[model samples]
Target: MNEDTYNEMNQLHESGGAVATVDQLIQTLRDDKNYDRLFDALLLKKRLEMGVPVVRPTSFDNLPEDRRAEFEEHYVNAAREIGSLHLEAGSIPRAWIYLRTIREPEPIVAAINALEISQDVDEELVDIALYQGVAPAKGLEMLLASHGTCNSITVLDQQFMQLEPQVRQECAALLAQTIYRDLTATIKYEVERKQGSAPTEETLRELITGREWLFAEDNYHIDVSHLHAVIRFCRSLDANRDEVRLATELTEYGAQLSPQYRYAGDPPFEDYYTAHHHFFNALTDTDRDAALDYFRDQLAGDAPDSDKQLTAYHLVDLLRRIDRTEDALDIAAKYLLSVEDQLEFSFAELCAETGRYDKLMEVSRAQHDPVGYAAALVEQARTP
Candidate 1:
């Protein structure tokens, strides 16, 4: 039978406890003789292992104790058969699954045997440690003894997080002893801490100067607030080359991001806008123009109204910087009409810079903003 049919049969057996589903699976096993019998045996073994209730008019409770014991023996035998078949087929993933169904030390021993033959044991070991209740400390010990690399460290980190708090504390020293200690372990630990738990000063220093900070690629799954905290902490310290370079890269990245980008439970819109401004202000002329082009593209696209407004504001600033005052004033004039209250100060400032006192007075009157009106008046007086 195809994989979809097998999966559907399994799901039907699980949810409805249909005996017919099991019968069909058995019949398919018989008909497709050349197809790996191990797969068919594993399907039935998994169902029994999960304790799917038997669907029949008569219940198992009505059966004698000897009958129940016989059924239990059948399941154990089936699991063993499935394990042997999978091992013969060289399907370690399937073998591990069936082995885990058997009781304690068998699963552990089988996993070790699989590792002996398999070239890569990282994923298999992590799975066993996570699902089979294998001793993670022992797994770490074995991995370390083999002169494991970063993959082994990652496996240990995953297993560490899955461990109970007391067990994790017990294994902490083992993790510390691993030669391949890296940010993966630190990030895992930090992520589990209660939100807003401040990092130690030394931890902050390591995060900024460590390889993770300098060369880590962007990943959306990463907690941005952690990076933000790192940057903020670095700013609090004495300025250093690593800190300055990290800050600059992060700033450029922040600027290039579109206004449409959002995360769940983000900070206030004003904060995001302020960050964009800081990024744009820090860019070199060439990079700033590239950013300006991006903002212009966003303005021309079918962006949300709020995004358009933010883009227009940045576009105006870029134009002003590039000495395209007239273009800036023109965009400011049109943007000011609809967004007068928010853009009044900026529009008035632009007008004064370009000697458009008449336009500044118009904005000041329209918004009834004393600051813009006063600044415009001061510029008007200063004009020869």
Candidate 2:
């Protein structure tokens, strides 16, 4: 129909002429198979709002299995189109959206439970013996039986953690999933309790130990102390190439971000500038202070003062930043005597890199603690 004809039909439909408009819209759809999916989606939404159900073009159950697949596909496509409209308009009812878009029973359960709508979902059932009595319950049971592989369970756990404890407990009983003592699980639950969302990096660290935070993805049980050591080293540096590289890798892997200084990999810098540019917006002085304090506390407690831990050697770089050259020299001397071959080579390089020139000369001298010849070779590599 032309514009005038369409307008007249719409006016008639708004004035208790629903049946005629439905017939005309169906005829229009029949002729145009490639019209905008959004138009039909909106029309179905309007009808649903008016508490009207469209006549199904195919009897879903009576069709052969392959045809049933086609029918379900149409419903899902229509539902997605309608969902996009609702999301864009920001006025579409959420419950109706869930009823339309959720195809599988587990996802439906997750969606409704997330909303906590408290409506009698039971009364909406149509297939009394199948869906009402057996199908949904069976789907839920099967979902619980294979919980690890269920994306719906992940969504449900995330959503459930946001609800009040009493509400979460009620839902948990029905789903047969509990937030156990797994540190990540506990961290997630604790964060939700305090902030109504997941924990940020600094907050997560306050609640979980280094060992607790180093969970393996597949096994969930491995001591990744080495990984923790790597992180602490990056945290102490003022700015350097290696620190920036490590931070980039951690963020890409979805690891936590802290208030500690971010290295830009090239020298002339203000602290935390690279972090603001890429990972977050502007950083406050308070954020900088907190991160620096945490980094130093970790250094004093957890960071190793040995050559095998080359990253810890950044402490000398840090000491140089604060003008503690004498302390830096003492640390350099300790590491020089501490380890063998590769680590000794790296520690010697670190002493030179951080500008402990006098100590480098002392270690290479005839009066050195070790024989002078070995120290002479290290001093040669240190010189320009």
Candidate 3:
């Protein structure tokens, strides 16, 4: 790239009876630590070997069919080598440049995946792996491994959820699994240390099933706040997933803690862990009727008006999760339509679902909702 390198390249060209000038130039560039030009030099060498113009953008369509495959194969192999060299030097951004060009991310992704997460994750690699749109799931896994659960949850909540739906779900699942794993390990270690032997499996329920002595002095395992946040994220995971099942056990453990540790939450989760255990079990279809009945009981209490409405919406959501949308519509019409103001649950949408315009109009006039009344009238007219 410098004047001396240019003069040396010309000399190598003059003496190119046996060796190639581009190869000599690449070697010179590598020796001088001039990798920027080394990339161009490598491209030049490939172009010369393939008999393609070296300016830029080698058009595969213009090349002979017999040679195109060979050229492509060589190009991929060369690019992969350079990219791997950069990754070995802890230069993920530089490696990504070539890896992305070749549309082969497996090497870099595997590199990040192979990281011993107990050690520090390369911050630049995390940036490329997650934000730059390559291997996002593994990036999230690394963050969960190297960083603490609290930090991972905060970042996932504040940032990662904005990604595509599938990517967002993957991140959410990772958070749940990581939390379940850490919490399970902590409890397992304590049980093993206290007792002579512990459960060999990863079931949190079995670990704490009869271990009342573990909580005798008002002691706790793992961060209670992390447990709460992780359970909230676990809602996105499939009910039958192992992580969700493990989280269910976590709630069961939390339910048995002392009164001091039992924190009240909003309606439906008013009893926090106890309520969450019911909700999760219903999702997993284990003791399904009992969990559904637990929430139905919440619907009957003469609680505050707003709290009652919250329970209504929560109950509707639960029914909807279990393929009971028709039931959700009925509950929505009964409760959401009678609320003082606009509730989170949409009664209009419920009407649209099952042609329930008749109830919509009834509740609309009772609640003095002109918009609802008009929409229901229009919907009724459009039917049949």
Model 3 segments beyond 4 Å from truth? 4-118, 128-136, 160-165, 198-202, 337-345, 348-384
Tens digits of lDDT, candidate 3, 1-384: 679877877887787831377778778877876665676677667667767677663344455688888878776776787888788777777888889999988878787667666547777777877777577777777767677677777766666545775676677677766766777888888988887787586677777777798788888887777777767666666665677787787788788777788777889787999888888888889899998889888778888777878888878877877877777776776677666266546777766776879888987898898998998999899999
Point out where model 2 deviates above 4 Å. Answer: 1-325, 338-351, 354-356, 366-384
Clash-forming residue pairs, model 3? none
* Count of clashes, each model: 0, 0, 0
What lDDT score belongs to each candidate, Candidate 1 first? Answer: 0.51, 0.41, 0.75
Q: What tens digits encode model 1's per-residue C-alpha lDDT throughout 1-384? A: 578987989787888675566666666674654224534444444445446443331133444554576655665676676666566666656666656656624654554544542344465664454445565655555555554444445554555446665445434444432311333345435534633564443332343333243323442222344333323222222222233344444433333333333222221123443344343332334355555555556667786776667557756755765677887887777654577577444566678678998778777777787877787788788899
How do these models rank on TM-score, best leading? 3, 1, 2
Off by over 4 Å in 1: 1-223, 228-245, 251-282, 317-325, 358-382
TM-score of 3: 0.64
Candidate rank order under lDDT: 3, 1, 2
Give per-model TM-scores.
0.30, 0.23, 0.64
Indicate the TM-score of model 2: 0.23
Worst 10 residues of 1 by lDDT: 232-241
